[model samples]
Target chain A: MARGHPAGPTGPAIRRAFDLLDLFTTARPRLTLSQLARHGGVPLSTAHRLVAELVRWGALERDPDGSYHIGLRLWELGALAPRGQGLREIALPFLEDLSQISRENVQLAVREGAELVFVERIAGTGAVPVFTRVGGRFALTATGVGLVLLAHAPTEIQDDVLGGRIERYTERTVTDPARLRRMLADVRTNGFSISDRQVTTDSLSVGAPIHDHLGQVVAAVSLVVRHGTASPHTLAPLVRTSARAISHALARRR
Target chain B: MARGHPAGPTGPAIRRAFDLLDLFTTARPRLTLSQLARHGGVPLSTAHRLVAELVRWGALERDPDGSYHIGLRLWELGALAPRGQGLREIALPFLEDLSQISRENVQLAVREGAELVFVERIAGTGAVPVFTRVGGRFALTATGVGLVLLAHAPTEIQDDVLGGRIERYTERTVTDPARLRRMLADVRTNGFSISDRQVTTDSLSVGAPIHDHLGQVVAAVSLVVRHGTASPHTLAPLVRTSARAISHALARRR
Candidate 1:
């Protein structure tokens, strides 16, 4: 949060570099140097110099059109994230099995601070559309995976989220803190979470926790189906079993 | 190439930070601060300060074990890379179709400089075992997709690769420049590339190019099967058709 403080240990130049990289997103993957300068709040010359350095370092790639894009090198580095590709690779087969049997949307997610990040998602054909993108973030109070992760999260993170205003996506979303608190307790007691049309109007998701070798809940797995097509009772068992299998696989691999 | 000049436009501190991040690989995803300092060629104090800033910025994550690893933020950024997850997501359904029909390994790769980076790979159960990893790099001369990418790459890149020492993975790997040039020409002429026991002794791969809206070969897709079980002649049409479908989908999506 330091803006141009010359005395901080975090060098201003590195912070500026981070600013440039942060400007890139799924929506704006390609940007001209002028756009980078405007969005990054840096001068055109500064942006030019920083972009040149990033291109040389293989962090940002310059296209034939003279626009910049997130490069393959950054993706290669991101592949080393234990909670990203590492976890996704181990859980993929099990996630595929869940998707095959249920023929619905299957997702794997991990809590990042007070929010949730989707690691991987597989959409089953003819299934209800779910607006989930891989490596995208969602609020921790809405979907099934988000609810499960929030339930098992540390108290501080939970408190921060619970005390803050929760965004309601649909009429069925539970935004009341007291009721949401009880929902968390029930998720703990029932060993799974069923978010009935909480994230979207027609999709219901069943999520279960995936534990680590130390028995800590490291991630959550979920299956999203049409609200009337499948019962949460049946889907929960399949998701729970798959999550357990993936947890065991993770443990054995390590 | 700018090793340790303090007067360069690219700050040495930022470069050192990149060096620290570059150390984490699939083989070693986590490292202590001491290891980072040693590998990054920075003083312990400098490494500690830089790491603290990176962790605060969510570029690096500090685990409960006190080891640092690539963070979810980086993966989110990587999901923006058009040649990485963006290409993979667009090509996944086709890759799945290829996997289901042939029951063989499916791969997608793009040229990175003179080398090749595997963007995505789907292994067919009980099929040939492959060493390719998603987000992993490989020699451009030893795999089917690699050959297709090399064939379509710029002339300077091809010359650079041909001029360098080509590491042979198996007896079938083409290391001779004249022979490799002929192979590249053949790939361009035939609309596909066949690596007969080039990457591994027991496996063979057939690859075809996927073009963008501009008719440029943006990526390559392949199917790897157990050698001698299925002929590349049979797999070529299947692979090429899938690649075409993906190319069409990419064009339509934009």
Candidate 2:
């Protein structure tokens, strides 16, 4: 029998499926059946059925410990996303260059709806430890990538971010809406942004926008180095040049 | 109105859903609705319905040009795959080291089922262009990472590969099952594999296995360089050391 209303649109069921998948995140990479049931807000039977289906389809896998985790099939499919793997593949050479030359943490990110998702990151062997993970989400006010993304976001999204809770990451993080707005304007005008000891006490990041053929900021590239070692001014040009090259490469693909 | 399989097991429906997703490979990144329907072997109505569901959930998205492609959400979920992003994350540092020091193509890969899927690749600036793509699949009988993985695969899989059609990329590629079998034995004995112009005409790759805490070969790392510039013997130690470092790092995580 059908699980739900037959006449109703399939939108809700699809959303529910996505919600179930979303239950597994970096923080909770693996979960038991009961845990998934509770987190997904589905009945035990429903959770069991869906989980079984997902596992069989390879969207999820049951580990040796019997906990469910995202599967390789999902990752393979995700590699097809232009904004995710496509962007990362194109930007990787430039990101690698920056990471190797500066010996710093290099990151590439894109704005997804209202959040910024790290597409790729290259950590320098001797670079300061920073809090960034690939495929992880972060706020749009504190990070160099975030500032570049926030600066170019649509008006409504910009308003929403500035109007919402601005979580402070460090003592130097700018949380004031007016100040953040001004900083975003400067990012647009100056062609780069400096998040000096913003996300962490010891890291400073310089970010620049990577534009599409239409010249809209589609992504951001950043070089995060140990604070006090080099000025953001010196790094801004490097970041901007990489971003421009990425933009040029992307334009050529069109 | 549950369609033809209203009374059949739900398993098939889920399998068909996955089958639809499986149709999008690196070679076929985008497809029209009819193309997807035909490839998936689902009726137009059913394919349309499932496509609509997937689209709603962001598992798929319609490109600006009106073609459907895999979505960012799928990539985000895929990033959670341990075999995919997990291995890449751990090996990235060591791979970066190899890339920087050698100034060549650094690759990380894992064997999924019987095929070698490239997990990550770093193309050195001005380095010889290699044919490998991240998330793309290659034969288990060719390339450096493929040899390492093939050497470690179960006996049945090894036998099946040896008995099957062996596509040759170059004259140096070992299509003779007997020769390939001996090469795999050598890889297991030597702790590394050398693919001397096997995949392409002008490139050579040296690969080594990355073991886990349990000493299982979980992944492989390689360096691809121009054939004439550096001998595989010279690159073997560097790749093996990096692979060992990655293994140590992964072992600590367990």
Candidate 3:
């Protein structure tokens, strides 16, 4: 390890570099050098040096206008993530089928710590607007895919989520740990999950777990539609079928 | 920059970290610590420290089998890349429309340096087998999208590519600098590109440029079919229309 003069405020060079990268989000996808320095909480000189290093490695790109954004090399590296782009590639065809047949929003997600990250999303004809985005994170206690993943997560993860504060997105969201536990039990028993206006009052979602070769729940697939347009019970089988297809594909690949 | 002892092999910490990340690819998505050390040409001890730092920053994940894979955090960050996932999100609907109508492979790509990286690819009905993968790089002189991007590239970049060694995939691939230059000129004049068995003998691709708000060629979209299945002239207008729709969408978004 390099144990000498650190460039940034306090952390190691790697930490500072990631801190700077974390500053870029959907709302602020592009940032100038000063904005990066201010948002990353580093000195301007340090920020400049770190940004130059990141640009050199193609982790970040400098536009002609002098602003910086995440680079293609990082995107290529990220495509190797098994739970992210890798899973999406194997499941996208099935997701497209579900989207076309159901004409509703299709989503795939995996549990990460106490939260769930959306791996892929396909907008269907007349699809309801969804708050979830590909690669975005959400609470494990809400959303159909999240509930399925939370249901199959390890004991520690379940406890961490249920035992902590549950964020309520709508009035229908179940915040009680006892009720949430019961819902999880039902998910395991029924092999599917439903979020009836839990995320948005105007929408309902049906989700099912996708298992790996070891029979562990590795991910969840879901379909979101307008609340009154479709019943969750009617949508459950369609979502479950797609989920099983993805599970089989994953097993074959593994 | 941290101006002290370089962690490994005399490079900065950021370079070493990215060099390690570049080791993960489609074939080798997962690696052991020893593999990382060996592939990255770093000392075992230095690899351990750097890997730990990366893991702490959520750039790498350690699997249960004692292997490391690209982490979800990196994927989330990569989603912010304007030339990668950002462009894909905007152009996907148009690409899907083209795919649904053509019932053939549809691809989206953008220029990075002298090469083009595939941003998205939708497999179509009875789609011919294509060698291109999403996030994979290809020569700017071979594929349909590559030609569209190269035709609009700066003079320096064109000269750099024309002056360098060109890899040939099939006997019909245009390799001579003079011939390649004429093909590029025709692409600009005709407002589209046709790659006739340049990459693979069994495939034919038609491409059109997607312009940004400034009307500059920021990306390219293409329709690829099996050789003799569809004439390039018949497919050119469909691809150009979809590309124009995507360009309009992008312009409106800006």
Candidates sorted by DockQ, best first: 3, 1, 2
**Model 1 segments beyond 4 Å from truth?**
A1-11, B1-11
Query: Where is the poorest 10-residue window by lDDT in model 1 chain A?
Result: A2-11
Better of 2 and 3 by DockQ: 3
Per-residue CA lDDT of model 1 for B80-159, tens digit only, reads 88888889889998999999999999999999998899998888978878877888888898789989999999999999
User: Candidate 1 vs candidate 2: which has greater TM-score?
Assistant: 1
TM-score of each: 0.93, 0.85, 0.93
Instruction: After superposing candidate 2 on the true structure, give the runs of residues whose Cα lies further than 4 Å from its correct spot.
Output: A1-14, A97-104, A124-128, A194-197, A201-204, A225-238, B1-13, B43-45, B99-104, B124-128, B201-204, B225-238
Measured on C-alpha atoms, candidate 1 has an lDDT of 0.91
Query: Model 2 chain B, poorest ten-residue lDDT window?
Result: B3-12
RMSD of every prediction: 4.3, 4.2, 3.7
Interface RMSD, per-candidate values to 1 decimal: 0.9, 1.5, 0.7
Q: Could you give candidate 2's per-residue lDDT for residues A1-254 as a string of tens digits? A: 75654453333454566688999888888889999889888878777887887887778988777898998889989999988998888888888888888888999999987889999988887888867888998888899999999999999999999999999879999999999999999999999999998889988999999999888889999999988999999999999999999999999876
Q: How close is candidate 2 to the true structure, as a TM-score?
A: 0.85
- Model no. 3, DockQ: 0.81
Q: Which of candidates 1 and 2 is the stronger one according to lDDT?
A: 1
Residue B248 of model 3: what lDDT? 95
